[model samples]
Target: MRIFALETDINKIKQKFCHSGESILLSTPYHTFSFFFSSIRELFITIALFVVGIIAFIYDLPMGWTLGVLLFIWVVFVFFNLLKAYVDWLYDFIIVTDHQVILVDQTSIYKHEIRPIHVDNIGAITTSTQFWNIFPFGILKIHLKEGLGGDTVMLKYVPHAEEVAATITRAVSSHQSRSQTSAQRRELSGIDDSE
Candidate 1:
């Protein structure tokens, strides 16, 4: 699967990072049902338009138009709705790296918000699934530390949330450990000591 025309290869994405030694542990987009169901209103509208077009074709209106063209436009409308949903889902993503948990939210074609929670700054993680959600689809909330405004990264309609959370948790732990060890080494070298 591709995401907004971008290749979904985790390694390729990791390599794209400007900072060296960054490794992507997990990368995920919203679940398939999430994308499809989100455009329900558009789907209904497209269906209604298609029915209208068919009616128009059947009635042989005063305008000279063939059934083929009507059907083509109907298909195009339907495709547009689907493509919109896909583009929205594709552009937004949740990614866990060795250093942080990143939430890439694309609100519009030109608007994007990239929030990265450093491993040491993550306060908590919460997840919930709707009663009707049969698959591993749910919402994920990554709470930041108190000093950092205590903001939460809210991700909706995520798939395999349990695994994703675990991946983030593990990455956080590993990052914290690495930071701690590096700090300890600095202390040992008297770099943190007041001379």
Candidate 2:
């Protein structure tokens, strides 16, 4: 069920962002551990509230009914919070196409930021994992060429970060080589643009 939903989302994004002849090389979300850590606070609070509510009811404490109602409302709020976190995680993804790399940072239902970096503008790709490689998670950073923002785009908690970085590096290399070949052909054909 979730896989279907994810496919649907990816399809929508491709339709909206991808250009003609652009093919997706890779699409992935942050690691599962990141999602768990992001929502840990809410999970703990929900559990604590449930336990307290149960204890109140069992002890026949004063205002027990009111306490139950309040706890129920709180639980509903927490549930919605968790749901929002899940939605954010589900919608956020990194997509690498033959032409560019797209990062969809979905913060809420109404807000999302899409950053697209052209393959030709990619200067470097790097990945770093935690000490001792405790988990199958790491960060991937793509350093853009100067003047095109001149900043690094970082993706955190990426699963199999090394593989992802390598894929992007290959795409960048291929694009650059193709561009150079076209330029050389133009030069050999005596194509003059300085008119």
Query: What local distance difference test score does each model get?
Result: 0.74, 0.80
Q: Candidate 1 — which residues are off by over 4 angstroms?
A: 1-13, 16-18, 57-60, 63-82, 107-109, 188-195
Name the lDDT of candidate 2: 0.80
Which regions of candidate 2 are displaced past 4 Å?
A: 1-8, 62-77, 191-195
Q: Tell me the tens digit of each residue's lDDT in model 1 across 112-155.
A: 55666778899888888865668779888888899999988777
* Candidate 2 lDDT, 1-195, residue by residue in tens: 224224326677777789989888999887877778778988888777778777877787776575867677776877677866886677788888988998887766656677888898899999999545799979899999897877988888888899889889988988989999998988977756643
| Candidate of highest lDDT | 2
Q: Give the TM-score of candidate 1.
A: 0.74
